[model samples]
Every structure is written in C-alpha cells, then in structure tokens.
Target: MKVSIFFKVLCVVSLIFLAGCTQGSAGTTVEDSVSLSMESETKVDETEKFNNDVDNNSEENGDNALKMLVNWKGLFYNPMVCSPYGCYEIMNRTDYTGNILYTDVVTRQRIFLSPDLSADHNNSSDPSWIDNTLGGCFLFTMDDTLFMSRYNYEDTPGELYCMDLDGRNRQSLVTFTDYNAPEGGIASDGQNLYMVLYKQDKQWLVRVHIDSGKIEPLKEMGGDAAFLTSAYGDTLVLKEIRAENTDSEDQMESYLSQIHTVYHYNITDGIETEILSWQQDKLLEEYSGEYLYLLDVDKESLKEVSLSTGEERMVIDALSAESINAEEIRSLYPIYDNHLIFDMGNDEGELKKMSVNLDNGRIFSIDPYTESLDAYGSQYLGIVGEFGDEFLVTSGTLEVPMDGIDPDGNPMVVDMVMSKLSVIKKEDFWNNRFDAMEPVEDVFLESMD
Candidate 1:
C-alpha cells in the first residue's frame, strides 16, 4: 500500500529540489505580470485583500475556511495548476507542441490560455485554441469552474471543458461518449460528480448532478480496478488494484504483489464500505479530511485510518516528536488545516521545514526570515500566492552545486535545482518576518527544443 506514498514523498522532494527540472518541472514561475492593468492595478490590489476578506478564513480567524483553497498546494499536478483564479502553467512548444500559461493570483496577471485570451484571438475554431490545447491538457476544479480537459485516457469520446475564474466563459462540457464511459478521473462532493465508468466491460459508478447536469449510473465495480480517491459527505472514495505473480528470490524482492482495497462508495445508497486492506510494509499516505494517513516504514510509525470508523490511531511514534524522529522523515509536506507540513534531517544533514500539530501533538520549526531563503534551507513548500487566504502561497525548489574540471584536471560538482514560487506569512511564519518570503523570480524562456 504505497500508493501516492505522499505523492511519492512530494516527488522525492521535488527531485531533490529540481535537480532534474523539466524532467517534469516541479513548481516555479513568475514575472508574467505583462504590464498589469485592469484598472489601477497596484498588483491586483496587493492580491485583493486575500480574495476580499472571507473573514481571513478562520482557524479562529488565523485562517481556515480554506481561503479559496490552493490547499495541497493547488493540486492538479505536473507543470503546475493552482487556482483561486490564478497559476496555471505547462509550456513547451516544440518537441510536439503544448501551451497554457496563466498566472493572476490577484492581478500579477499573465495569460496564454490560447494564442490570446484576454487579448488576441480570431477563434481558430476556439475550444481554447492554441492548436486545440496542443494535444495534452488537464487542469481541473469541479463546481467552482476552471477546467480544461483532453488529456484523454483512450476509449474515444473524451472531452470536457469549463472556465471563468477570470479566464472567461469558454464552454464545452459533455462527451465521455455522452456520460458513463469514464476511466477513473474526477470526483467531487460539492453537490455531486464522481466517475469510474466502463459499461460493456462492466465497472460503473457514475453520478453527476451539480445543478442538474443529470448523468446517473451509480454502482457496479466487482471487477476491481477503481481508483478515483477523494469525495466526502455522502461518500465516494475508491481504490481497488490487485496484481499477483511473485516467486521472489530476493534481490530486494518484488516481482509483483500489490493488493490494495480501500472502499466507501454510497452516493446515496450504493453501500460499499470496506475502508482499508493492504499488503504490508504499509504506506498508503493520503485522503485527508476524514482521515486515512498510514505510513509505517519499518515502524517509524504515524497512522490515522477511520475513513468511517475502521478505527486505528497513533500519529507519530518512533521516538515521538520534539523536532522529529519519524526516522527523520525527509519530506511529507501538505496537510493544511490540521497543519502538518514536514521535512527533517538536522544533525548537520540540513533539510528544515517541519510543522506538525495534527490536532495538538505540537511541534514547530519553520524559521521564516526569507531573503529568498537559502542559508541552507533547501526549499520544498507550496501554495504560491497573492493573499493565499492571507499568506502562505507556496511552491519551492532550489539546490545549487557547481564545480568542475575534466581533461586531466579533477574536481566535480553539480546539484543545481532551481524553481520556486513562494509567498509565506503568519508573521512571515510565526515571527521571523524579514521580507516575509515571496520567491517568484520567473524562468522558462521556453525549452525542450
């Protein structure tokens, strides 16, 4: 059960802080401000009062209602996709075209949802034209708008679209062979929308109402394969996966053993329940809000379960907190409201970040005082912002190391990981407030030849 191993430990700490940059760009983009304008734009009114004071999102007014959630660092994954009405990047023009570069977390404006959106456009048959989203696309957000599909997973009919978190009303929203042809991708609990279709080869579970878009189906599974993952209220969570074939002769073993299970279907009455089945060496690691955390790498403990009373507790045990010892957990950041950010390895191994307090196991050490952080801070946060609920807009990556010599002269160095998109606060992180962080330095004069 290593699925999403915390997004593979935040993608191996963003590939050791971008040391392989576009080997899948792990966050960083800024400066597309494009001469800001849209009426006296003092940088979108300094991020428009963090989206116009929704009572500072309350965690006792310290921040909570998810201040327009970019939480889990604006998830969508890969090449970027943050929202509260800004931050959508994915660029590369040659090596098989691609483009979609927006950015406006409050008027630091920059556009490219097409050869011109908010600007040029003679409609090259617009479906958000840029040669029709240049072959690959997937940016999402369900009921609150902003979508761009066409990153299809085969079986044809695929296509869905939406917009208006400032990117205007670009339409087109139906066609997965007109509903119930899904292939595991999409889930929502904000009034319905959950999928996993297949039909003749069996596998349904549809549901799509959000104001009557109607699309039904409801339940059938039994052949396994599921996988969608999150959706609360009246239930939806999934994951089936099975695999076999292992006569291991140990070379670090693993010729195949998977298993996995985790259930929860019930969109009103399809009942499916189950909550957690595994394969051992535990790791599961996700599905926040109603809990399901897990992690037990050789017993350095940390768990949660209870996706609805499968019970199970113990959060952090291998020498329990005081600045960390879940085996110096090298990285696990992102768990907003119940707090929980991670990264440890002191004792001169440097890797900082740490925050914990998952309902009061208290433990802090985010040392904020950024002059663009790096007196050995290594970076890996995420939220990237303009009043991100009021401060803590993250995205990070920085690992510089350069020394060289060849041809008979010896000495080498090369670690260089640069890509950041910062914005942290709360006294710039509990009172260390120098510049209070804002690492947006921009780069991508386009590459991938």
Candidate 2:
C-alpha cells in the first residue's frame, strides 16, 4: 500500500509540471504575436502619413502654384512675366559665355537653355570681366519653346533665336540689319512676336510668326520721334519725343528742349490715340483699365487721367503737403486699384516703404521694409515687387568674396551687401486690416472730424 501511494504522488507531480510548461509556452507565443502585430501597424501608419503629405503638397500646387522665375547673385536683369512654363532671364556672363537660363517659377530650379555663344573672354586685363554682363540678352517662352535675343550692348541690334526649353533644336528667326533699340521693346502674343524694326530713317512694327519664321510688317510706327515702349494684348504703346526749339530769345534753351508724348495703337483696329502729352516731362507712370495715373515728374504731383473722358484731376500734391517732400519720394508703384507702394528716401538713403490710399490721400506706414540678419557675416533683407497678395524679396550679404588679388596674389575680399530672391504672401495687403502702424479707418476719421 505504501509503494502504491509513492507512485501515485510521482504521477501527479509529473502532470503538474507538464501543465505549467505548456502554459508558459502559450503565454510567450501570444506575447510574440501581439508584438509583431504592433510593429506591422506602426509601419503602416508611417507609410500612410508619408503618402498623405505627398497628396497634400500636390493639391496645394494644383490650386495656387505660386510660380516665380528668379536669378541668383543678382547676375541677371529682371525676367519677363511668368508663364505657365517659367521665365527667361539673361545669365550675365562674359563675351564668350553668353547663355540664357530657364528657371522653374515654382521650384526655383535653373537650367541652361542656350548654347555657349561666349567669345574669348581671355583678355589680359580682367579676363573674368569680359562678357560678364549679360544685360543685353532678352528671353521669353511660348508653348514650351524659348525665344532669345542675344546682342552686344555697344550694338543695339540683336539676333533672334528659337529653341526648345532644354536648349534643343535652335533655329535663327530674324536678324535686324540696323540698330534695334532696347526701348523699342519685344513682345509675344503666343502666335506672333511683335517688335520694332528700325531701318534707315523709319521705324516699323513687325510681327514674326513663331513656327514659320515669317516676318510681316504690321504698321509703320513713325520717324525718329516715335518708338515702342511696351505692348499689352493687341494694343501697342509707343512714346514720341519731339524737340520744340523756337526762335524765342526770352525762353531758356533747356526749357524748350524735348516733349514726351505717349500714344496707344490698336493692332486690330489700326487706330492711334494719344494717351498722355507733356513738355519735356513724363505724363503717365502706370495705368490700369480705362484709368491711367500720371506723375508730374517735375512738379512732384500725383494726378489721374481717364482715357475714355479725357478728364484729369490732382490726386496728391506732395510739394504742398508738410509730411513729406516731393523730392524725398523716390519711387511709386501701384499694387491694387486704390493702393500704391511708395518708397520714401530717408536720410540714410535707404528706401522706406509705406502704403498710400489714392482716394482719401491717407498714408499708412508699413513695417520696416528690410530686416537685419546675422549670418556667417552681415546680411540684409530687401523687398522686390509687391503683387496683389504677394511680394518678392531678396536677402544677401554686403561682403564680396574673392574680389581681386594684390601683387602677392592673395585673394582679396571686401565687405559688401547683396540680395537673393524670395516671395512672401500677404492676403490683407489691400484690406485695411493689414498690419500697419496706422490704420486707414483711423486716418479717415481724423480727416473727417
């Protein structure tokens, strides 16, 4: 009976040990499964987040896009208006290094869209300075193709060339035999490029087809006095300067010198109308719709003219006002219909920007146009152009790197300030709720009371 009891106790102990081992193994398996599931879920969440970010960026690009064409280091002139593709700017280079660069307005990526037409810049005196100024090249794009006019600054004439955006399949369009004034202007309407052709004693408005390279004379602009400034749509704007030198002993010779008149010609209607006329002065600074703003360049007065009615009135006479001098006003550019971006030249010679309402003659000071930034060296911020809801800016240092070497051939550097390009958006730029030190409503109320 005692031997039977001992065997029974051993069997029970063995069963208990087996059950405990099985339970521990099942617990480990369950734990491992749960850990693996959590890891898989985490990876899926990360992938989904990445995909969502991409989708959001695509959507934002589809809506506004905010395209801009920019050049670095202030090496090129301002580009043409932004197109659906991009903008074309002259890549300032030496004589043998002339090339046009295409910049994606949205991405700010630049691509060389022209072949190296640079001649030898290896002149003994400052070889790098040769062909370094590309201010003579003009670029415009149509239908994924770029049109470039490369010319020497000494000679105003240029050669027009057409090529793909990637600088492929280049073909010469037209070569002006005579001097082509830069002020004569070059404009494109997708179908044809209208440019001023100066041959001998006359100036002709010629239109060249992009695909066929056919040149057609559209209108005879005028003599040495009449030349084109800019073209909008089917209308061409020309400036006519006439010298009025009469035999008057009392009149000053400089006073009877030259008169400037701005005229508008319709390409479709063939009608010529005078927009602004002044005696040795600029009557029109800028225009919108049927209204044109006239700046009394000599008198420092602001006036508006109606093209339809021919009525004119003074908007502001700065000389008569006490707040600011007319001479102190350095620049005035319109942003919207009723607002202007005014630059007041301060005592430090820096341009201070302020917003002015044309209707009420109320002025509101904006934030300091530029901000000082401390980088590796000194830096500054600059305001470029102010659009309706956006403004272009640039920031760069005043220091010049590797300027020139002394007799010892050591690299020379100097303190200089330059600016790079950027864009900022301001939705309330036109509204009175803008972040201005002085509100428009408060100014209006003070004037009323």
Candidate 3:
C-alpha cells in the first residue's frame, strides 16, 4: 500500500490559533510626523501589542499556539535565486517596475524597501529599454539606508553601481571592463559590503566600504566560479564551485562536473579554510548557532558539522533507500531551534517534508504543498516574520499574464503575483515523533541471512 503523504498539519493548526490573537491597526504612512526617536517608540509599542496578543492567544489555545505575525501583501521570489543580500520581489516584471524587497522572517512584514529603478532613473520608458538590469537579488540594509549592486549596460564602460535602497544616492563602485557581475556576490554585515567578481577563470572577493564606495580585494578562490551560498554571523560561511577544469569540463555528461566546496572565512582575521567537498551536488545551510547542515544529492542521509570543531555527525539516514532517490532532495529550512524541515519527492513528483531529528537519526513525515515543481524543483520556503505566538509563511509561484490596466498608461496586469502570506500560530506545531525505526545496522547484518 502506498503511504499517505503527510501535509504540514501543524502549519495549518498554528494558522488557526494566530488568526484569533492578532489585532490590526491602521496603516501608517512613511511620511508620518513621528521623529526618529518617536519612531523607535512607535515600533516598540507595536511590537508589544503584537506580542501581547500572541501571548494571550497562545495561553488560551494551549501548546498549539504558534503565532502568525504579519500577513503582508507583496511579491515573492525564490530565495535560491537570491543574492547573498536576500531575494528580490519583482513588483512588475513585464514593464519591469518592481522593487527589491525583503521580508522579516519573524514578523512577515516587507521590512526593507529596495531602490526603485524607474523612479530613480526618471526614465518612463519600458524596462526593456535598459540593456543591463538591476534589482533581482538580496539587498543589504542598515538603519534607514539599504544598498544593492546595479548593472549599467548603457554606460560606455559597463559598471556595477551601488545605490541607496530608496534609489536616492547612486554611485559607481566597481568597473568591469570585460566581465559582468556574477549572482550571489554581495553580502553585508550592516557596515561593510562584500562582493565577488569572476574574470578569466578566476574568482576575486571584493570588499567595499558602504559609506565611502571604497573597494579592496579580500581574497581570491581559484576558479571560473559563482558564489553558491553564504551565511553571516560571528564568522562568514561561503560556498563556491570551481567551474573550469579542462578534464572535468570535457566530461560534462557526468553528474559531477566540478569541484564543489565550502569555505569558512573569518571576517576578523581575513583567514579562509576549505571545510567540505563532494563529487556531486551538495547544499550547506547554517542554523542559529555554529552548526552547519550539509545535505547531499541523494536524500538518503544528512550530516551536521560544527564550525568550531571540524567534527561531523550523521544526524539522519535513509529509511527506504529505493523510495528516496537522488533528485528528491527539494528544499531545506531550519525549523524552531533544533529541528530541520526538508522536502523530498516521491515517484509521482509530489513533495513531502521529512522532519529529521537533530539529536538522533530519526525522521518522520510532516506536510506537503500543492504547488507543482518548477524547473529547479520545490519552491523556496522561508520564515516571513514572528511576533509572539504567531509566524507567517510567504510563497511565490510562477507568473501568469493578466488582462487589465490601471489609470496610468502603464500595463496594470503584469504576471508577477504577490506572495501568498499565511498566518501560523505557534501552538499548532506538535512536538511528537514517529515510531522509532532502527537504522540499517551494518551492510553485513542483512548478508548473514
């Protein structure tokens, strides 16, 4: 008998509890009379109110009360496609009038505003008029300011422009004479900006002072490579792939084409270390603490490695090896504190979550989303925002053309759909477990038969 795929019933249950606790207030305009000091006060007051509601509702609903903070209405993008700064939500893709937006994973509010290209450039012409594009990746935000890299194709010498998040202050930071910006370069620590440049089979890490637009080379990892993934905290974890090996390039038909590795680079010491390597596709995810979770191509197992010590532990292993294939590893997210949420596909291509135990090698089915797989497989999942007892879930799907127009002559019905933000309560998540199943003891155990 085919097993019934479990839906994230906890997410739905949490949503029910959150709906009761949240109290909506009137929207405040950006030009409100509140001073900067008063603005801080207002934010605190709003946060308190949100927290109070969550606390009260969670208490009433018992353990099932996970709070849903904000049900923000805006466009969403795949986090995987995002730059190190974060993902950008296309406000208007057809006419290309979108903004680079980020959601507070906890509060679910569209917190940071990206610089508006059309408004900043003052070019009412369609976005197609521009040769090189901007504003489709994560952004770095500090205080009232945000920064992102823009590609200026029309300029005599194509350059990467660093502009304010609001599209006000624009300046050229780096000039690329014979190259273009690679995806996943820009990262920020609220004070400094780090960017990566690829040229002539070499990768250079560039550091730019956000205040002065000053550029400096930090280090170079040898390869015609693109930044794969990054995590920020006390130390920075970056993953890059060596794209050009003559022999490997020739054998492109094989699944393992390049050397994929993760580099643990220290921000204070400017030292770098190669932490891990694999022959096939691998993924690295950093959690709240110093733990880094590595998931390989086959969904058969997962390894949790500590950054402090090079020690590694196998936290999960394949339950049904035949049922779990290499292509089924869809998406991964750090859930709560210790648990990890991952999605995998069955033979039918349906997605299912397998909650793996961090302390032990235990796995159980959790939930499923109805959306079909995109070219890259499962949709990117992220925490929108969290208040007290509530959290929000935001998801974006592929665009579909619409038939309508606004009062302005600009086409109103661009295909970009605002993310579907669902409110979830903390109480709904059940901290339970599946019946304990022994892992494959040893290869020789079954051979004894």
- Local distance difference test, each candidate: 0.46, 0.42, 0.41
For each of the candidates, the C-alpha root-mean-square deviation to the true structure, in angstroms, is 22.3, 25.0, 14.5
- Candidate 1's displacement at residue 185, Å, is 10
Top-down lDDT ranking: 1, 2, 3
lDDT of 2 by residue, 74-162 (tens): 11223332333233344332123333433332333323332221332233222112233333555545445656665535554566777
Q: Name the better of 1 and 3 by lDDT.
A: 1
Q: Give lDDT: candidate 1, residue 388.
A: 28
Q: Which tens-of-lDDT digit does each residue in 95-192 have in candidate 1? A: 22344555544343334554324333324442333444434555555324666655444554556666654445666665666443343346555455
- Write the number of the candidate with greater TM-score, choosing between 1 and 3: 3
lDDT of 2 at 256: 52
- Give the least accurate 10-residue stretch of model 3, judged by summed lDDT: 436-445
Cα distance off (Å), candidate 3, residue 387: 5.1
Q: Is candidate 2 or candidate 3 better by lDDT?
A: 2
Prediction 1 TM-score vs. true: 0.31
Top of the candidates by TM-score: 3
Candidate of highest lDDT: 1
How do all the candidates rank in terms of TM-score, highest first? 3, 2, 1
Relative to the true structure, candidate 3 reaches a TM of 0.59
Q: By the lDDT metric, which is better: model 1 or model 2? A: 1
